[model samples]
Target: GPQIHRRTLLLTAYSGPVFFHILFYYCQAFIYGTTFQHTASQILAFTLITLHFAKRIFETIFVHVFYRLTVSFYSLYLYLFHYWLLSGVFMAYYIYYPGTCSSSISLLSSALETEETSLYFLSAVWIFAELSNFETHLILANLRIRYPRPIPKGYGFDLVSCPNYFFELLAWTVITLITRSLASLLFLIAAGLHMWRKAARKHEMYKKEFGSQYPKYRKVLIPYV
Candidate 1:
């Protein structure tokens, strides 16, 4: 019944950003010619985006229990392609054209300048979502450790069947809001749809596995919404 190794899928998906980010870094100097500029906004976006993928790689390698799940090669290819396309478009567009959204990087060089309450609020929300997501992952990983085959619970699980998915969606939404890029917004929509379906499938499976013992009040993905 096994098709492709889960580690293969995970490493392939996460390695994509390393390739694309390097390509973009070099191309920036070549295209823009020596005067390769990095703005504050650009730096912020880069740090956040890079950290996001790095965390995913770390979690996949250490936190997730994927040994039992068999994924097709085609599915791995699809994962790589989708992330590459989205991440490529986002990094290229945002880093190169920092002036396109919100304020220019120079003007927003310091918090004192271009004092915006909304930016801080969105950033706070983003950090919160990321930390919460990581906590959920830890819980999931611990569950697998305690049981041969674990059922994920705790944290957001008390409300929704897939708290990780919901938090992931929220994190991306915050990044999209921070960037105010339509491209990123579209990526969020696509990712959200995928997560929604994944959560539904997971919920169905839980019901089949646990029968009526599964939480009756749990939503598929979102909590109370």
Candidate 2:
């Protein structure tokens, strides 16, 4: 049953990214007039995203539903596990073949476009966002589950509440900057804001529920409050 459940979760995670990739390929072909090589590269990116998403969803469903894991534990597992995989893969690629992971659009060009400072800055921001997100998850896990065994009060208030949404927003914002595509930027911005609003509501819920017991944390979109 556990194995079957894990498989289902993996499918759910993979489906979204696969759908996004197909959509992205068609859109790029229509809008940007991408060549066959460019389309193929986009397909590869799609596969990477799909793999990451599948692992995340599998951990989430398996830990929470099958094993009766705590929210914090599952959240930490999902968040950290995905980033670890992504960062590891990215680092390996970057180290082994320095310039190979650059824009796929220029794969077939005689002279590939040089790297811009903005691209570097964007990549830095992405790394920071991932670190911050993983740290938040770790903190939440420790606060909610690792300390005392089944403390009911811990669940009443969130520790570093809504950090997932915040970090995700920042990550997507960086992605937009890196990609520099209007469609991608718009999608990220729209999705980020939507998640921001949802996180704010969650904060309000925690405050209402826990009152003074909730941590005296700043309520900014980013950690800088």
Candidate 3:
């Protein structure tokens, strides 16, 4: 299996949306405005999605420490294709094709507009989760730099072994709440399940490294969930 740099992999994953979504929106707004009307919901959704990917790209380069983390090219391609492109298609269908005979798609736009107060609250929660996740990554990166066995503690990490994953799940949960998109909800569920399994594996590794010293109260992805 040929290996690819984690940084390269992450950059590619995020770059897909930054490139495709922007182009998609531009064409929909300027080039094809006669065919597609740009609504507030679509603009907001696009901003939120693009900002999410931009934050990821920034964090992958500046916050996370790649170290010797190299994954197979197949794994990279799987993630890039499944998440970046496929997810974009799902989002585009809901956002851009509102008049395409789907009541559910029409409902998504209405949900965002109708739930103004709830959306604002959820946006705050999302921002907090994003910052918390970034802070957790910084803690882990610094721990690695200091050559210490990484034992995440405090903040979101006080309860879950993978607080970053926890916050990530929360962030997506908020996004689903704001957009009310079935596609994003489904994606969140799938990603949360995958993160849960990975967190359990990581917790076991911590146990192997620290033995009884590992936090016994710490759960895997969520606390007592």
Candidate 4:
């Protein structure tokens, strides 16, 4: 099968989702004017989904270095839909649900009791996990520049083959918790499974490439694996 550079595929893939999310979120105005109001959770999902892809696009351009060079472009369809179209469609479904479009119908209300507190807590966790993921990417990007210098293990580089994947999954889980949306949960599961496989392969590659130099106890996106 034909392949494309990782950077190009990543940019194309993530960019698709960002566009879809924006379109779906603002469709009320575009398609029906300001006549419709979205629930607070819908708006929050829109923001976080946008922010998540924006971060990935930024990392693809500036933070990640391509060791593998290319991957199948078929992955572009899977990833593009995975990020943008899937989220947008799910979001559109919930946002456009009959008589449930008002802020009063907040999806966060699903959390019971501590809705506001829980939303805030999960949001804080999302921010932390996303930043942690970005930090790990920075470490990987610096690995070549830092050369003979010991790589930083403070971010759990020694505990997992891909702390970035763990953090990425954590961020998705936060969104799922905050929205309590089946849609977001579905996306999380898809992403988790995909990253889990990729992480395992990367872990194996690291072992074969660096052997004794790679951290001995490091696992693949999990501890005690």
Candidate 5:
């Protein structure tokens, strides 16, 4: 397929959204003409997104290597919609909603504190998965350097063809649970579907490229599904 420059497309996609989130988050008063206090949960949402996308920007420039194969304009649209548009909702609607939706789970009610506990647990999981994803990318980068092609081996690789996708989904799942936003759910669905297709495609590629040496039992994106 005809494609754009990988680094240029990725930098634009990731950096644009990160800039939007930071601007909307801090400049709430200037944009909306009024300012409201940010709940703990809202802060967490903003922080996690910033960290996640910043990591992506860094990975795009330094970590991931792109060669002949490249993506279409669809990726540009998908990144903008997922990271920019839906994340705009996180800034404009979800965070500054001035309701329970924007408020911290711990402050909602007696049982809500337990929700915050789960939020903490989820955050931990997200961090772990993010690190693991980075590690996988490093592995791939190294492989493409000296080897014919990349073959993921460690972490969640033995189980899923794309553990990075699984980890990405898991991190987003945590974000959705923490923010409890419908827009976030929509983002999750959109990104998850795209990743599912990509995972299946890559799985087939590995099978054809590596033959029976590639793990036949390895699933696409998830273990059971």
Candidate 6:
């Protein structure tokens, strides 16, 4: 009981920092608006922070109850991977089509030469992310319904290995593209590295635990056919 309680407390405290940052940034956004470039950074920062906190909170509050344990490795992977890929893409776009805003309020103005292109790209990214998110949830639900207990030995292949991590990465990649700031890019990279390591660890654990019986079908980071 103490171990379980300690685990829960650790999860909550680990995520509390990001949650606090989200609240702080949100309050600042409301007060300052988005007319200035600084506000753009603020928005991006808060968005990243919120996403991190939300992912952790969801896993802590719901996934544990539904799935019987926190998806610790998956959560880390999702948080970092999405941000890294998206931030790189956004940085590239920013270099090619640089624009300036007078203030946070004017940040959304269509004043850049490639405004239309950027908008279209962002929309497409959002749509893709949402689709991925939906698919991931579907997979998770299927796993929980079909395989309730100690995942069948070697049957891990049928389980939704790490669908959430894949989609989570995709979502942040889109976010980085939408808000191409150096700060955002840095954050993404930092988060990505952290998560990648965790994913690797999880992969190793599954392999060791399941041995040859583990579904040969399931890949660590991707879905196994």
The prediction achieving the highest TM-score against the true structure is 5
What is the lDDT of every predicted structure here? 0.73, 0.47, 0.73, 0.75, 0.78, 0.48
Candidate 1 residues 5-60, lDDT tens each? 78768777877876665556557656555455565445555666777888888998
TM-score of every prediction relative to native: 0.83, 0.52, 0.85, 0.82, 0.87, 0.50
Report residue 149 deviation for candidate 4 (angstroms): 10
TM-score of 2: 0.52
Model 6 deviation from the true structure expressed as Cα RMSD, one decimal place: 8.6
* Ranking of models by lDDT: 5, 4, 3, 1, 6, 2
Candidate 6 lDDT, tens digit per residue, 107-142?
A: 433454354455455556656655565555554555
The best candidate by lDDT is: 5
Q: Give the TM-score of candidate 6.
A: 0.50
lDDT of 2 by residue, 165-219 (tens): 6766777665544443454455565566677777788667667776786666646
lDDT tens digits, residues 80-149, model 5? 7766777664544555555535544554334535656766776798899799889878877887777677
User: Which prediction has more favorable TM-score, 1 or 3?
Assistant: 3
- Model 4, global lDDT: 0.75
Instruction: Report the C-alpha lDDT of model 4 over 49-157, residue by residue, as the tens digit.
Output: 7899899999999888876899987887777677656655665455444334233324545554455665666778889999999999898888856756453476868
Error of 2 at 210 (Å): 2.3
Candidate scoring better on lDDT of 2 and 4: 4
lDDT minimum window of 10 residues, candidate 3: 100-109
Q: What is the lDDT of residue 144 in candidate 6?
A: 57
Task: Point out where model 3 deviates above 4 Å.
Answer: 29-37, 99-114
The predicted structure with the larger TM-score, 2 or 5, is: 5
Instruction: Give candidates' CA RMSD values in order.
Output: 3.8, 10.5, 3.6, 3.5, 2.9, 8.6
